[model samples]
Target: MWKRGVVIPGARMQRALEHPGTRRFSLTLLAGSDAAMRVQDEILLARLYNELVVAGRIHKTTRRNRFKGLDRIIVEVLGRELPDVPEIALHDVGASSGVTTLELWKTLLSVRPGRAHASDYYANMLLVRCEGHPLVVACDEEGAPLQFTLGEFVFSAGQRESLFRPCNRWLQARARARLPDVARVIAARKEGRTLPSGWSVEVVALWHPACRLAAAADARFTLGRHDVCAVMSPRWHFVRAMNVLNPGYFSPERQREAVRALAGSLLPGGLLLIGRTREEADSSNVATLFRASSAGLEAILDLRGGAENKELVLEAGKRS
Candidate 1:
């Protein structure tokens, strides 16, 4: 579902739908490629690096390759479960536009059976006064809800702004990184060489913290370290595979204790599939969380493609 040039819903749209408090909204598909078209204010950059698939800039199968990695992690998780799971809830933290969600559903449903839910904080639901009172509406253009309002969930613009800030900031930073290159590409358009498209740019712009936090909240509340933290970058996307930098602990001091906690929570033969960066300094507080949840190391994959900046994949499992 998330091939390189395919236009999917942007993160903002995903937020509007996944947020529990939202109610009504409508959409009409645009012409041309999805990445080539979008609202002016909501421009999205795709994550892949391709001059053109048909023109032979690079292998057209890059998109499929990324999804293959995602499938590997999913299969690994299922393989380690005691007797095969009838349903599995995949938590894609920092899910932007639910692209990963669509891909996961397509893959897992074909083989294993289960539910896949992607999450992002609700952004479009707004609270306002009508005539002389307060009301809530599911809206997009800041004017009004098209035809409906639903439920009793109350929300304020301030809350929406707060929840949306982190992801917005992340995108803004990527846009900044991309602007100069885009300008040059566009300036050279006299020969018909132009930049990929708004959405195409975004796919590459996605980085670790920004993209992950965008979908982070989607996972259910209960997570145990040994539970096999399956993570994938999906091909053409910037991330390689998810990694747990220090396994269960990021620092020397907490390493052993964190490993213990992770081991205690995991069922026998449980696993962790992580996505991380090859960049030397890439680290985070998640070490505390993973350390408390994971068991001893099992297998690890260095999925980096010799790219200067890329994420890595790390796996840990509870011994039987």
Candidate 2:
């Protein structure tokens, strides 16, 4: 996850930096809904799970899974592709809050703890998340989220009418005011004091999750504030750019450059996986796998979400 203050070399777009002609290769963009968006509808919440907070007056927006297609063909592919090496290094691009990132690591480690033929290859993995601007965290003075309590309910005893006005009105009109209402928020702290009412929300300092995670100082995992456009690291075995690449966030040329940067960060014959997803439970996503070669990155597979897609959608690289 990318932090606000930490400086990561090459994380920014250095227009002065240029890719040599030899390194620049051609790539064909896959059409249709074949890859996923970085699918995390629920980001790091401002407050802890137990804290009482909501997304201001309006409800929060969640559109996709934190990680796309984790339980589907992806795992199968990983099991088959990942060598039984002693340690596997993965670069999870655009890892927000590290929920899906950490979960994926745990699943990978736990799935085959003692493979009969698998090597003891298990070690630290890298997660990179960064954007051009700063991340806004709604944490209180004491470090808890004040603006948006991540996991807390939105409704309170006082604001029940506003949040659930429709339902309440329906019940009154029908003369059968039944059916339990929305979950109410619990009392929470505000600026080091207990909030008397759940609706007493306020704007506290922005508390980005990257800051908290960075401070933890975990050795098993290292955080890098990296920009996908200019990743500054040695090549790796695998790189997953989940839900970050699209014409919407960046232009076509910049999109190509982003792919180039991610591909450059891979070792020869390394695997570069790109995906974007929407809708949490559907798990239906689009994924593209490319291989880094002397000729540049070549698409090897196009997964259109769900468990059905297993065959490789091989695409020939376009060379200028």
Candidate 3:
């Protein structure tokens, strides 16, 4: 099934698999995959974060509090305004790592046969060639995959000072060193390859606890890849586009197109909730609700802990 962190074969991977020339390619990268992790074959920062979680520096629970205000908006505004609503057909788009939808099933699915669906564009299947990366296989002198056990490595000042260490640990540490310069590395790649700054990391998976729990909780909670301006599903009662259609990531025209699609994806009298989370998982988020009507997607309410809705209304007016 579509389990988060567990990638299933998709169009990108299928294309690679069907081709004869570059068939060794495997994997569809996670949506918005960290650029730093693509340089080397290890996710050092993620590992460090995982370490923090283990040490109690980080807590790994579904931060359901983020959606509390959105929930209120749903019940008070849409539930009351609609007057004749029977069920809610909802979609949470741009749901990064599925973290925003965690613990949502309790209120969404279990509440007397509720109807809602979620969406996200997971980084596409990532294709990794195992030959270059030593961790995936053990090669003999002739460079053939061989039977293996624990892998060893040497980490020290020099040939004389080198100390033996486990290969996995060394790789993990090597990954951390590249974190600070990753943004620069991405810029360099975009400009040109002639510059000397070149390194890569490989992310085989994204470990999202929220998505996993949601998938296991109910089969109705669908997970799939969707670009905001190009979602090809039928109309929904409500669509929540969070942290996706910001001006920084998309140009004005592109943002307008995305807004058009979001509005079009809603049924008449349906609600469209849009927002961006500012800091950590705090409630310092900015959200606005627009209800689809004959006048087009009309801004109906400015949500709590959200920015002024005038800005949202202005944007919608420009598009309208």
Candidate 4:
């Protein structure tokens, strides 16, 4: 079974800084949901204190705002090709409040409608919440594209008054009909009789095309202190700020350097998504200007301690 949210203890975080491996961080726009936004704030604040003040880092001035780029990158990546049977993880480097942890879970469940695999190494905890019955049908890769896809789906929580309110409508009658089958699917996964190693699949109604298109673009530009409410989602897992700080203002040269650093921390097949403005549109050309910054660097630094080398996703780089 894949490990879920695990928050690093303060002592461990400190020890990690001393480790030789690269550190990962990310900055992206705030989520589009209320729960996600609230959670992100708490996570960002906590990271700022632990990473900046405690560690005496330089980007202290905008530590709280650095995650914007990471945010945009991740949103853009997922937006481009959301996993139908996807396994997503976000490392919260400066996760003081752990709000980012909570929001990540909410978004996975609410927005795309699927089961989530979460891990919070820092907290040393893992949880799997099954919402709206998820059906997992399998197939050989060559047989039928893994028998699952990453996209939006309709859900039906049954009760007219649901915890998700109207959004619960994302649930569908089909899901309700398959409730029995979905139960079996869940049971099989837990017993390791169905799901493959590190894989989960759920069927959901098609996600809104507009939202899909927007997700394709860099999402970091939309996140801000006032836009924290945008982070909410039903997918529950160990979520946190992409990185502790946003590097939107760094110079082109520095931004590229930061991206290199962040990319070093990601795991194999892992992603570092974030938002950033076009350089040509940037007027001041200040290293700290959000409009003209490198999304890759910002996202990498925000991730909590872990395997620092996996892959990188930048606006300047390929969206895939």
Maximum-lDDT candidate: 3
TM-score of each: 0.31, 0.45, 0.55, 0.26
Q: Cα miss at 19, model 1 (Å)?
A: 34
Task: Name the regions of candidate 4 deviating beyond 4 angstroms.
Answer: 1-52, 57-79, 112-258, 265-270, 274-320
Across 1-320, the per-residue lDDT of candidate 1 in tens digits comes to 11011223566445643452322222211212342233222222222111111111111111222345546555554545524554554543323334444565556657665454443221112222123221222222222221111121222211221344564334334333433443443344324564444311111111222223433554422211121223222211111113322332244333333333334333334443344332345322111112112334444332332212112211222333
lDDT, residue 41, model 3: 25
Question: What are the lDDT scores of the predictions, listed in order?
Answer: 0.31, 0.38, 0.48, 0.31
Model 3 Cα lDDT, one tens digit per residue, 25-85: 2122232345323423233222211211111121112233667656655655655766566
Q: lDDT order of candidates, best first?
A: 3, 2, 4, 1
lDDT by residue (tens digit), candidate 2, 59-103? 212122455455334445656666564555667665533445555
TM-score of 1: 0.31
Candidate 1, position 311, lDDT? 23
Q: Please report, as a residue range, the 10-residue window in candidate 2 with the lowest summed lDDT.
A: 22-31
- Residue 202, candidate 3: Cα error in Å is 10
Global CA lDDT of candidate 4, please?
0.31
